[model samples]
Structure formats: structure tokens, C-alpha cells
Target: MPKSIVVPEGTSKPIAPFSPGTLADGVVYVSGTLPFDRNNDVVHVGDAAAQTRHVLETIKTVIETAGGSMEDVTMNHIFLTDWANYAAVNSVYAEYFPGDKPARYCILCGLVKPEALIEIATVAHIGRP
Candidate 1:
């Protein structure tokens, strides 16, 4: 059986009923991350591009905390409140994964939180040492 572990960072607390990140077998799965800042506040209020950046940055930090880097990411699932914001989200996303981008899926959906225009979840592999 694979053991499951949670990602740890003492700076901010999780406000929802979810683990920040989980380790199972040799892979790390990070939960859908919102555009919350270090203080756990939604930082990007008016811009979808800014919100996308925040979501990606948060996912990157969670992956790194699990001993993985953005380069190690296998897949990403992106959720946007509106499809019209695709270009804006894509532009910001390209900045983070500059080369060898991971496979990704983008979907337009109604968000649980109104101010959040974007959310990103990631899967990464921490290969055997």
C-alpha cells in the first residue's frame, strides 16, 4: 500500500476541507489551488491574468514543498470561470512553464468562490532516489 502524506508550510493555513498536497507512492498530488496570497487572502481581485498567475505560483510552491519542481510536473488541470479569459490565462501560464510544458486540460466552469477566476491543480513525480 502506498503511504499518503500532506504538504507542509507554516506560513498560511488551509481554509477549506482539503489537504494542501498529498504524497502517494512516488507521486505528489496537489489540490486545486486558488489565487490566495501568502496571508491566505485572494490577492488578484480584478484581473483574470493576475489570478491565473497566483494560482500557478501557489501550485508551484506546493509541488516544491513536496520535493518536486515545476519541471517534474506530469499534468495540470486548469479551471476558469469564463472561457473568454483563456488568452489571458494562457499568457500568464506560459511564463511559468517556459520549456517542455506538461500536458494540461483547461475547462470553463462556475467557481465555488466568486472572486476567483482561476484555479490550478497539479500532479508531479518525485522519481526514485
Candidate 2:
């Protein structure tokens, strides 16, 4: 199958040049997402948990837009500006994938939006490639 980009109607616009998600060969790849609102303004600036939750929510929407689900997620890449917020971020993350957790790698790095506490990207497989 040919590759297709996924962009849910209400999600925040991309901060840079990248699709919100891409689907090819039955696999969906969500780009690192920030906690921004429909107006493209950052949300939950000071609260790590809230920011993480919103980030995952954005990822969920993108994957679903491509016809997949959180259960279909195979892996994720987490990017945060500070390591100190790791535990708080994980607390919210556990709520999203309560049963089958996807393989995840967390990285400490500054984000394009310095107010964002976390960003997440994912790879999901809905079926055979």
C-alpha cells in the first residue's frame, strides 16, 4: 500500500515540518507530539502529568485517525526536557495502556516549545504489512 499521512481534525497543528502520523504497509508512525491545544498554543506548561497525558492523547488520536488503537502500539519514544519529571510522566502513561504496555524509550532533551513538559511519538501495527 502507499503511504498516507494522518491528521485528525481537532488536534493541534504541527510546530514544524512533519506529519502528525504516517501510515504505510499497515504500520502507523506518530511523530513526536507536544501538548498544544486546537489553537496551537501550549497547554499544561507547569504540570508534567497533565502535559504527558495530553501528549499521549494526541498520539492516540493520530493513531486512531490512521485506523489503529493504543493496543496496536508496538513502541514509543518519549522526549522530556528534564529527567526530574520522569516519574510523574510515567504515572500518567500507565493509565493509558493499563494492560499491554508498548516498548518505550525515554529521552531527556529540550523541546521546540520550552514550556512543554513531554512529547511522545509511537509506532503501531494494525495488521500484516
Candidate 3:
């Protein structure tokens, strides 16, 4: 199947060699996203809740740019630098997906950037069966 890159307006140029998202076979595969500013530096520093909000907003943009919405998301891969931030992350996360939460798994581990407390990659199906 053919795939197209999804780069929404104002998206920071990724520090790595990867598109922000890829659309293939009616599915939008969003790359792991961090809470970053236009300079590619981690934002919200030590605040996990703010960081989670930023990451989710980034993913929301990518998905919407690919003709989908948060409601279309099927799964999410969440990563965190510390387990203690789990509640903070989830509290902000619930605001994004208030109903019919997508399937997800959270891992307690290190991120590419030391100040980045959260990273989220998402999958959304936007095509009909």
C-alpha cells in the first residue's frame, strides 16, 4: 500500500529522521511525540501534566491533519520518564479522551530527552471497512 506523510502546519522539524505521521491503508500512524517547542526543546520541563497536554495536542494535530480526530484513535503507546508522574499524566490524558478511551499501554522508562517526561504515539483508523 502507498503511504503519505502527515506534517501539519507549525509542526516542528523533527530532530530525527521520521515524519510526524504516516497515512497508510486508512490508518494514521503517528510517530512518538514529545512535548517540544518550535526549537525542538522539551517544554513544560518538570511538569508532567503540562507535558502530557502538549504531547496529546501534538498528536491531535497530526491525526486531524490526516483527516481523523481523537475519537478515531484506536491505540496509544505512552512512555514516561518516571512512574511517579503517572497520575499527573493520566489526569491530563482523561481530558483529551473523555469517552470510549482508546486501547493503550504505559511504560515507565527514559525518554530521548532528559526533560521530556512523556511521549505518546498514536494510531487512528479513518477509513471505512
Candidate 4:
């Protein structure tokens, strides 16, 4: 099946050659999102919780633009620049995904942007059983 790109309004232009999200066969594949402003500069500086919230909001926008919701998310790949921010990340994550959380894995690694403490890519199925 053919795929379509999903780019929500107000989303920052990607720094690289990739769409923010792609819709294929009822699934929305969201690109790894960072806490960056429209200018592509990292936000929230040293705060992990704020960064997580920003990333999730960006993901939400892409998913919704692709006709899906956070509830439809099936999996997530979470990346953190420091393990010290794990708990902070989790706290903000829980706020977005209240119950029946999606399957996810978190890793500690350096991000493309040093000031970006967290990045999350998501996969969600829409209108599929």
C-alpha cells in the first residue's frame, strides 16, 4: 500500500530529510520527536519532565493529524541523554498515557542535539482491529 506523510500545522520543519509522521496501512509511524521549538532549537534546557511533555505533545499532534490518538499508540521508543532523568521522564509520560500504557523501551544515549534530554518515536494503529 502507498504511504502518506503527516505534518501537523505549527510543527517545526525537520532539520533532516524525513517526515514528521507517515501513514501506511492504518498505522502512523511518528518520527523521533525532540523538545525543539519551531526554530529547531531545543527547549526546556535542563528539565527532563518539561522536555518529555513537549515531545509527547508534538507526537500527539502528529498522531492526531494522521487520524489517531494517544490511545491508539501501540509502542514507543524512548531515548534519554542521561539516566538521571529517567524518573522525570516517566512522570511526565504517565500524565500523557494515563492507563493501559503503550509498550515502550527507554535507553540512555546522546541525542542529535546535546540540549535535548529526551526523544520519543511512536507507532499507532488507527481504524484497524
TM-score of each: 0.89, 0.93, 0.97, 0.97
Instruction: Encode model 1's per-residue lDDT on 8-75: one tens digit a residue.
Output: 66637778778888888778889988888767777768799989887887788777877778889989
Q: Candidate 2 residues 52-121, lDDT tens each?
A: 8888888888888888889999999999899899999989999999997989899888888788888898
Global lDDT of model 4 = 0.93
**lDDT tens string, model 3, 1-129?**
789999999887899999999999999999999999999998999999999999999999999999999999999999988999999999999999999999999998888999999999999999932
Residue pairs in candidate 2 whose N, alpha carbon or C atoms collide under 3 angstroms: none
lDDT, candidate 3, at 8 = 98
Of candidate 4, the 10-residue stretch with the lowest lDDT total is: 120-129
lDDT of 2 at 99: 99
Off by over 4 Å in 1: 38-40
- 1-129 in candidate 4: lDDT tens per residue? 889999999876799999999999999999999999999999999999999999999999999999889999999999998999999999999999999999999998989999999999999999742
- lDDT for each candidate structure: 0.83, 0.87, 0.94, 0.93
Q: Candidate 1: which pairs clash?
A: none
Q: Which window of ten consecutive residues has the lowest lDDT sum in model 1?
A: 2-11
In model 2, the worst 10-residue window by lDDT is: 9-18
Instruction: Point out where model 2 deviates above 4 Å.
Output: none
TM-score of decoy 1: 0.89
